[model samples]
Target: GGGWCSSDETCTYRLTNGLGSSKYYNETVFFGEIKSTNKTVNPDFYNWNRIVVEYCDSSSFMGKANHPKIISRGAQIFYAVMEELLEKGMASAKN
Candidate 1:
């Protein structure tokens, strides 16, 4: 996961990893544990569909950034994701 950055200097450093930008992201990721489909390992959620939000903003999905070179929009990403999920049936999800 991408760790948080508290200052411009640190956030600038984040550019070198997936935590800071998609340029460094992997094309695919492995999902395990609660995200697993193996009934033996995740009995209750074995059949559930899941989505993985990569930790990129480094703000714990709480804040935005004003740096000219850094694009930080954690809050916006969170709301947009929620909106899309709701529209796609999450609004009526039972679990």
Candidate 2:
């Protein structure tokens, strides 16, 4: 499982990590331009899989979503890194 998150030659304004707009842990990131990110992409993005994102309002976590990921080239790279982590964890579990 591998994914990648990168901007195409056209992107020259901002940066971000994942897909599907702005999903965050505390608050939904709907505003501001994404400058940079450390969140890696999970292979689940390239293929079929499930993803859960914490959605909240101005107060707290309101709910969650179980859906597939739709990301850009940059976000895809991040997804790939996430895939590597998952694989490593799985392998370690067997050992």
Candidate 3:
């Protein structure tokens, strides 16, 4: 089966494009459900401050490749994001 980038060649291609990088990301994005601003639609989580972590590593947040060309640090990214969130009130969240 084909994956996002099966080989170094394809991964290199992804690295240059928007798939493995965030250089072409938009400044704003809107999500539904928990991240939604509509209280009627989101109900429980509408008023909570939300963040949308961009998936730019192309490794499903589980890779830690030490390649010379491609810097696949998905695990590090996940932990860093979690730490930041914890520092920013998530440590006190009941749910």
Candidate 4:
């Protein structure tokens, strides 16, 4: 229900429920980074769950595989997280 955005474009966001306190809590974070260019266009996105998907293919977009390949671990991880979120009902916008 709460979040923060980075002021610098190169900086990444880290989520925490508490700040300026003596205690620290451990939790998983999603979409921790919002590139500077993206932030400039949608500052309000800081308030929402932000996912920065990376393309691991070494070649140009056209050279990329059309389907999920074994080497596409990044995509696999992303989908796994999405599935888990959906299963837990945490992916809902109402949350």
By summed lDDT, which 10 consecutive residues of candidate 4 come out lowest? 8-17
Error of 1 at 34 (Å): 2.2
Residue pairs clashing, model 1: none
**Who wins the TM-score comparison?**
1
Per-residue accuracy of model 1 over 42-94 as CA lDDT, tens digit each = 99999998987878488888877667887778899999999999999999999
| Model 4 lDDT per residue over 1-95, tens place | 12222232211122122321113433544443453235655585656654532332222112222433212133555566678778876666584
Provide backbone clash counts, one per model: 0, 16, 0, 1
lDDT of 2 by residue, 50-78 (tens): 33332211112221322133223334444
TM-scores, each model vs. reference: 0.88, 0.21, 0.80, 0.28
Model 2 TM-score relative to the real fold: 0.21
Off by over 4 Å in 2: 1-10, 13-72, 90-95
TM-score of 4: 0.28
Q: What is the lDDT of residue 92 in candidate 1?
A: 95
Q: Over the full model, what C-alpha lDDT does candidate 2 score relative to the true structure? A: 0.32
lDDT of 1: 0.84
lDDT agreement with native, every candidate: 0.84, 0.32, 0.79, 0.38
Which pairs clash (backbone N, Cα, C closer than 3 Å) in model 3?
none
Give candidate 3 regions above 4 Å deviation. Answer: 1-3
Q: Highest lDDT, which number?
A: 1
Give RMSD (Å) of candidate 3 vs. truth.
2.9
CA shift of 35, model 1, Å: 1.2
Better of 1 and 2 by TM-score: 1
